[model samples]
Target: MFYPLRERISTWTTSQQTAEEETELIQRKRIQDLPLLRAAKENDIHLLKQLLEDKNCDPFQRGAVGETALHVAVQHENLEAAEILLDEAPQLINQPMTSDLYQGEHILTFAACVGDIEIVKILLDHGANLHAKDSWGNTILHILVLQPSKSLLCQMLDFLLSKDGGKTLIDIPNARGLTPLKMAASEGNVTMFQHLIQKKRKIQWTYGPAATMMYDISECDSMEDHKSVLELIATSSKSQAHKILNVPPVKELLQKKWQNVGRPYTWFLTAVYILYMICVSLCCAHRPLKPREDNVTNQRDITIYVQKTLKEAYLSGDDRLRLVGEIISVVGAFILLLSELSQAYIFGLKYFISHNFWRDPFNIIRICYSCMILVILGMRLTDADGEVVPMSAALVLGWCYIMYFARGFQMLGPFTIIIRKMAASDLLKFCWLMAVVVCGYSLALYVTFQTVDPQALGAFYSYTMTLISTYCLFSNLLNGPANYTIDNPAMYSPLYSSFCVIAFLLMFNLLIAMMGDTQSAMAKKKEELWKAEISGATVKMEQTFPKSHWFCSESSGNDFKETRYISLEEKKWHPFHLEEASGSSSDDESDEDVPPQNSQERNPNLDPYQEIREDITDRAEDRGNVDHNDNEIWEEELFEF
Candidate 1:
């Protein structure tokens, strides 16, 4: 009894498992019938209807190719059949056909290729994905060209183009890298070829096999097609292909313009030299001195001592005076040269720094010169005996500065415009200019004291200390470390007051204004150069016209010939001599021909030439009626010439 019960349980389990397996197999068969049902392929539809009518049938079936019944109907050029199936079961249209197997030959691809415009419209209306690429990466347009019907292909293209068109067909390449246009050319489809040519006028035949294939197609039937191909090939080979391609012409033009502008190395040097000279002049202009006593006793004592000292240490001849003058001039010139060299170096350094060179040669030279000058000043200030004054060092540094300035000036000779403009300006460029002047003045005071009394090194040292303190005050003011007010009451002494006033009015104002003016002028010149560059670019662009074949057609050529102008001007293009060509005389023309004259031409009393004379007279009368303020109008008229 137990064995019978176990056998019965096993039999029931086996039966249930068989039923589930059968159901799965039936579902799989229904899925496989989907593409056939969609394509309206008769046999597939019969099988689908049979499955649907039966209680065990699956209406939502997909085929081996992952295509549903609707996909098959659309693909098989059966739009009516698809519509019937969709009306019966609307959800089927929304299902995405599996793309794994069919590649570039999906349902929509089939519809587009087969010229089933109605089916495509229905699918699109049902929210079919237009941008969907097939397994082989072919778009609807790509599939359309594969069809034989030219009219249908054109219709499909027009429909796709109607919404957000002007996209390049060349972007879609087949497995072999052949564009749709190239494929059309290969198939000797003149209509498709011409359509693509018109659309993308600048399209080139660069793909090797595709180009050869195009040539082969053109040669298949007649020499005329071959000639057309040859002509296209010839045009592609020409240098004007770049122009035809509509590429900008400014880059090449700019390169040529820069070459013509020449090198700016020399101008850089000149600017440096001028700056150096100004610095030296500023340095030499003022010197620190001890206050002189005016009282009778002190004056008599000082005078007697100075006279005895001068008598003992006097130079014998004009040679010393001449030598001194020469040295001063040399020093001044050296300072000028150094300033100019530094400026030139600054300008050149801009270009060099772009290439990652951080060190500027001119700046280094300036720093060295500054250091040397400081050393000399230190020696003069510290040495009680004045035995190690480093006169040779001072002279050497001065001469070096001069040589640098000269070299800079020579380099900048070609930029005469820049130099003259800068020199005439009131811009203060170099801070060192003032520093040098102050130092030179301090040194001069030391020299003067030495001349007065050969053993006055201590007095000279005190004066140098005062000069250093004054320089420090100026430096603090410039650096904004301290306010520029003269807080030190000692600076209010009559001697210091006069020097400060002179320095402010003469040196500082003049130098600053000159530098400002120079900068403005240089900026203006650069602007002019930029304008010239733009103009050159415009001219280059004009010369590169005729890139678009549409603009080079027979009608365009004729229009160009008639106008004799490169750019289209509406007023110029308006036809003249219309009445004469129509054989109509002025008298014979009705009121319609003349119409009513506008306000500008309504004066009937004025003859053609008399009207012109009257206009001039009216303008003169208007001028005569104007009021003058401070004789401003008269001055303007006088200067009009």
Candidate 2:
């Protein structure tokens, strides 16, 4: 047993020596890497070359935090040094570069994040894996699209897509499950979104049936956001929402959404609307009255009396506590006004004017609400009647307050469409028809009876009397117009008898039929109508507010910025077609839409950059702007662009 233990002890000693020696070598290599790491960070190409030439030097070696020399080259934006390193040892292309700032980030991801096109191109040319992700499973394309930088975004997309021969490379999702297209939509960046659309068309990529993938549902922080996202997806160019999800009426549903409301900047407008409404309601609630014991009081006493009157009105009015209700109502109205004004500005002067701006039902209601407040204040100035609440104004305010629940109904989805159809469409039409028919009957009946009975309708053909008489003719208002027969036999004209029969038989029945048909038609196709409304709303929202900054802007870094902006002049997204981009003929029937897997590889002559040069060269020659050398410079700069 002692002899066996001696053997085990000898083996243990040997293993310990090996372990010690390995630790020493690790420490030595790390010490040696210090110079190489320094050279890489400083972009000293000569030092980098010298370091690599040493037989013991390992370019593949990780620094203390797993960053390779290539990662250093990318991290510092050292294109020249990166080139030399990549050239001398091309295998350094796909290093697992990690650092404190960019922990576990691959070299490709680092290059893309910097918006360094040339470095990205060089890395791609050297077979760097575009598919490789960082710790977050986000590819370089995912990082590039985090913000709206058309130049970097388009080029990076063009390069990867061209290399991959299609959209499959760029379609990779991030840790949050957002694909590049959905990310673009989420930001509401039109230019970048259009680029992605063009790429989709270039690849002829028909999106699959996964509507959830097309739009990130969880990105919607509110009901408004969800509605907007649904709309954006529905109306998008590659939107398979029509064929795949095939929801109907996408546009109408979105008209009420808060697409541009999430930004903190717009919250001020909402606050204003709320405040203005509150002030209006307070002013209308109660007015200051004269002191009861007015025996030639001093100015201070008058002031005190005025203050007390206002204070009581502001606190509680008529024992119903209407002061609190009035204050809240006016605040909401103020909020409504501010919101409307902001909407007008966002909609633009031309759009607002052309749309007959005030025709909106909300605008009409606002006008009536404002008018009632004004009239009440105006009447207050006269001693004849202090604080005569304009019944019309009070009535409108009552409706506006009650309609608060209606605003909350937007969250009900398809049912919201039904409500809108009933309130905005059917109700308006019914009111218009009623106004024409009722006014005609009111005029005829009032003219016939007013001369004979002066107080025939009890108010001598005043608006109130005429309205009451009109209602009486439709049905007996407590045996209404029939009471006139007891006073005088002449009250029954054949014309009056015919008018009552026609009004009840034809007008009421017609109104009922029209309203029924409208409601039934919508109910029959409620699902399709709701979807269509949502889709239209999604598309139209972008049309209305192109500058709306969506939520994805939160994660955007220096990596996703405009290194080279595609000018409005260059217009061409692809060398061939600013025309197609303009929705013109170039987009019409492209043979290249169905290109094969190796189309770009097979056609070296079809380089879009080269095509752009030829077009610019021809244009420059035509304008006599500069000789061939300047043209060459311009062409070179264009390629850089």
Candidate 3:
């Protein structure tokens, strides 16, 4: 009996050891599956398949996180593994294995949050509910919309919209009591906001408590809150406000800043006026009666005498004062030209007057002084001593006329084209014309001095000679072994004169070529203008009449049917040319209908006149109503934050 008990005890110990070994083996198997589950969770499909091929592997088995292979595959967006798992075991897709492990996050919620549209589609295809919500009470659509990718959001939104009972998706609120529209507005997702608006329009959704609360908060007393509400409304509407908001407010602010800074041109005109007045006052103070024999030796003394004599003639009652006026003008002109060409006082005088022109009467006085410069040039050229040159009066006048006319053509030709292109309004054109006249007078004085004495030409003559020499050199440099000769009357060379004639012909040819180019540019510009008019008119006509009136019969029954056909054809072929001409005519009419306003007619203190006037009136009335006691109430309270 004792031997039998010992054998039974040994068998019991052996069985106990085998049971412990089996448990150890099971534990080893469980530990080995950890990496495999991790690989599955990371969407490493090859490693997962290898782990599944292990003889110890159970496909239905849960990991430490209670996430089965199928749940892991779906959560990681491994669509291939999901397909395989579904094929192998179709029951795992809907199984909520990780609800207890991952703070109640289901597999579908993970897929939606990650924006795995294909995985989400697969789950839906395999009998996953479209309206499935996570532990946070957030729908799959809500999670998908929150993903950063706009394209993914659009895809998910489209999918939800196409599904049965999908209209209620926008109505579903999160834990924050904010609907999808409010969330989209708050997040500033413009495209999502537009999508929501379109959905609301199609479904005719009534504004719920959440939308009403947002509206109420928008009207709160704080400026910050008011601004936030305006932004929210502007974002949510998907209307004109959205387009306007996209255009930066800083652009308007910069424009206002520039206006307040004032105009450089105005300051320039003012300085000119002041210098002119100073010169006039000095001339009036020292009026001279006659020219002196020593005037040639001291030109400044002659200039002062001539200026004084002109002032005397201007104030005199004698008829002979007109002839005296002419003589004074002639002397004054010669002096001014000499001054300009010699560059004697040009730089110094310009620097002196530069500071004074902008003040009051100086601006106007400077403009009048500019007129004197040209008058001086003409008089000097016409009144040179006949005895010195032995030229007749008519001959002198003819030369003067030719020189002045050619000078005017040279100055005015380019200026006219430039001014025409630059000035958009008639008033601006008039201002530019006056500016050109002033500039022309100053240039005449410069030219008169230049032609009379080559030595007196200064930098202006040097620059001209340099430019001509450079052009000749460049031509020689570009085309080797070419002869280019310039005129030198001092040398008395016939060859120089012949070369000059050839150069003149070549220059004339160039001028002709330039004119041709200008003509072509003008023609092109005209064609562009016509095309613009045609396009504008066509758009107006189309807007005036419906699409049906363009091609369809007027009869009610036939018009509807014909419009569909016409619209179909239009979609196929746009035919912009056919519509352009009519559009242009309509545009012309509209342009003509709008009356133009002058600067004087517009209120200087206000821009966007109607709104500014209303704001001013309201503020004035409010100020009038306020008493002394109200001032205390109006004072802002300082808050310590």
Candidate 4:
């Protein structure tokens, strides 16, 4: 074929390759050599030896990732192959990988990164330079600081410091202007944070505030995580708190301010929700005669045909209003769900998990309200032309949504606060006791009524209904609708009377006493309760969302500026001991002068280790229960949101 003329720029490309280099390049490009590379990575001595004997094979040739056979071995932590490669060509120790993950990363850097102590020892013994900076400007110390397995990170850091003696690597800043200390602070590693503070605290306040240290506060996962960042910045920093706060511009995001518009907005939602519910109520007023017809039969075919036609006519013609209401409810629910998701995204997912969705009681209520509507949507999708479950869902949603305004208004907040405290305390215990007693009595009545009055109270559901109806009498939700408490007095008289005595006279009165004790206890802390309610109400208002994103998105306080502070290393300051907690255990005091980085592991025999393990176990058990006497059981309350 006659080829067209193409632009030839040999000067811009590498057209001057030697015969041996050209062959090696071809070998490097072949996918067939992947098995050879894999063998080297797996440290298969026999296969690797065979590959090494082939002169045409370039053992040190780069792959598509710009990694050599030796790099693969070190990356895979194959000490055997790495040793053989080092023996063959020691110069490869300083060669950098061109891969993005390990750009300009030498052998010792990768070894220190993976915490392969053996390979690190070998490379270090071969005069591998510890002073070399990688693409991230991290020394061995910075690479190891954030590792979850602190033992290896700790060991490498301690070893490197001991060798350097001056610890110059400790304060070296990266391209992002983040020193090892600041990066450690953002991780919320209390032990690492405290260790870094102890190592570098001698620097004076004249260095200005270290706002960069706590830059990750918005993304923190737990309240304790946020507190850890603040503790390091506010309590540990030698700089004044006001000056230190200057870095991140995060104070506005932290403090949720009250907006009066939230109340009106909530009422608007209430109106729309109520309108949709009213339509649903009209639909439910008339139901198909043969509703919930899972299993049914009739003797006369004509009679069956007539019944089916009447049922279909009733459902298809009259339930149009209900379908419209359901559609509107679904739309409203969808909008609320989207609003919740957007708000959560803006606040940061971890922060939303810790504070808004999990901790805020009203937020949980709103989520539950939306979920009930979702269930109604699913039921409608299933073409459930029934009235019972949908009606029950609407009733529950109406009351649950009140939680939003209940927390928002100033007057209602106090009442809700008392209810919350009662719920958190006495109501929780009482509900458990009530459920157990109800279930026990329900089973007994089921057997008793089956024998005496099989028609009225024959089914298990009948006994359950009567027991629940009598139970509701205690809450004043029902007065005297015990199905047969009056009609079949012989069957229901003893059950009703006994239930009243046990549930109302005993359990119900005990609940009131518990509530009184809780109320009295809360009354002693009314001032604190008022303060918390005020803060919660403000959060509720802020959560209403602004008509414009200008305040949140355009404000200068929304983000940090790109600025770097000078490190204290210029003045050559050294770290000293922090004040130990008083009444410290002998083990703690003994280890005071010793940096925590020096201790690879805690003493298993010590009470501190035992106590921490026990605490974790206890918290796990408490999380499995609904009650929250001591543990943070409320964290698990929102099963889904």
Q: Which candidate number maximizes TM-score?
A: 2
lDDT of each: 0.45, 0.55, 0.44, 0.55
What is the Cα-based lDDT of residue 326 in candidate 4?
60
Backbone atom clashes (below 3 Å) for every candidate: 49, 25, 13, 0
Question: All candidates: CA RMSD in angstroms?
Answer: 31.9, 28.6, 29.9, 21.4
Model 4: CA > 4 A from native? 1-256, 259-325, 336-368, 447-450, 453-499, 523-547, 550-641
Q: Candidate 3 regions off by >4 Å?
A: 1-68, 95-102, 203-641
What global local distance difference test value does model 1 have?
Answer: 0.45
Tens-digit lDDT track of model 4 for 1-641 = 21322334443244545544665565455424676577766789788777777787676777666777777788889999888777776777877778643577677767876878888888877778877777877765666665777656666665665556455776676665556655665443444544554443222112212212222232211122223233333222232222222222223222322233334554555676667666545544543345343445654333221112323533564556555656676676677677778868887888887656654455665566567677755654566544356557756665666654554455666666677768766777898897888777676666656655544543344766656754566565766444536265365567668777887789978998999987887666554344344433334433355436213332212222321112222232445445443434456557566556412255544554555455445544543211233223223321221
After superposing candidate 2, which stretches have Cα over 4 Å from the reference? 1-331, 353-360, 374-416, 455-464, 471-479, 484-493, 524-641
TM-score of each: 0.26, 0.39, 0.28, 0.38
lDDT of 2 by residue, 359-439 (tens): 335455665665565455445334334344474565556455433323322344455556555667767776677677667
Model 2, residue 401: what's the lDDT?
43
**TM-score rank order:** 2, 4, 3, 1
Superposed Cα deviation of residue 335, candidate 1 (Å): 66
- Shift in Å, residue 21, candidate 2: 95
With candidate 3 superimposed using the best TM-score fit, by how many Å does residue 280's alpha carbon deviate from the native? 64
Candidate 3 vs candidate 4: which has greater lDDT?
Answer: 4
